[model samples]
Target: MTFLHTIGAIFIFAPFLAFIMFVLLSRKKLKRRSIGFSADLTTFLLFISVPVSVESLWGLEISFAVAVTAILIAIFLLVIEWKKSKEIEVLKYIRKTWRLYFLLLSVSYILIWATGLALTVISFA
Candidate 1:
């Protein structure tokens, strides 16, 4: 059986780990950075929190919770950005910076998964 801590670690650590992996693999050609402490982070935090929130609120499984949370987060981010930003330059910046933002997010997710898997294996051993 999977432990809550394993899942939580993945939720928290995936982004940073992914960034480090990318940096190493890219041989310093690519630099890791974050857009800011804003909607993107909110989405990621919400995504990670979904499972726990759903289990607490509606008795949903982790996978289902994550799916719903992701959908909600995407909608929210899109709406907020569309409503708040009107300048073309800001939009352009967002487009250009999205790569790093997404890369960090992917890194974190992978780290979490790998940690969980390692924990599972170690527990079984």
Candidate 2:
């Protein structure tokens, strides 16, 4: 269904899409630390998106419970990070590799978005 495809696309690309938005806005100040944070955040969100999207399509499922558990775990991790935010290590190669990371992340998400759109269009056709 079109709705299903749209939801799938969103779940797949939402985190990456948001990351690109943030990265573009922070281009000048995007340090190695920020890129590291973005990478971790992107992985975490994608992990969550899987079960959440499954739940959305199936009404209710065990995956929904699992997704909630994962969310709680993510929250716990975030809380820990917040307390020790100043202790996080800075990436040495950030200045040199930040552009590459940004480019890859952007390309990956764009591809994901395009795939979703294609799925939606195909489902309707």
* Reference-based TM-score of each model: 0.36, 0.37
> Please, what are the lDDT tens digits per residue for candidate 2 over residues 5-119?
8865764647767456555666668665665556555654555554554455444455556556545654565566558674633353232234443444445445645766777
Q: Which residue window of length 10 is worst by lDDT in model 2?
A: 92-101
Task: After the best TM-score superposition of candidate 2, give how far the Cα of residue 4 lies from its true spot, in angstroms.
Answer: 24
Which residue ranges in model 1 land beyond 4 Å of their true spot?
1-19, 32-60, 86-125
Query: Any runs in candidate 2 off by more than 4 Å, and if so which?
Result: 1-13, 25-27, 57-119
Query: Which candidate gets the maximum TM-score versus the true structure?
Result: 2
Full-model lDDT for every candidate: 0.51, 0.55
Tens digits of per-residue lDDT, candidate 1, 8-84, equal 56644444543344445555453343323333443455455434444544465776645664456556656666677
Q: What is the lDDT of candidate 1?
A: 0.51
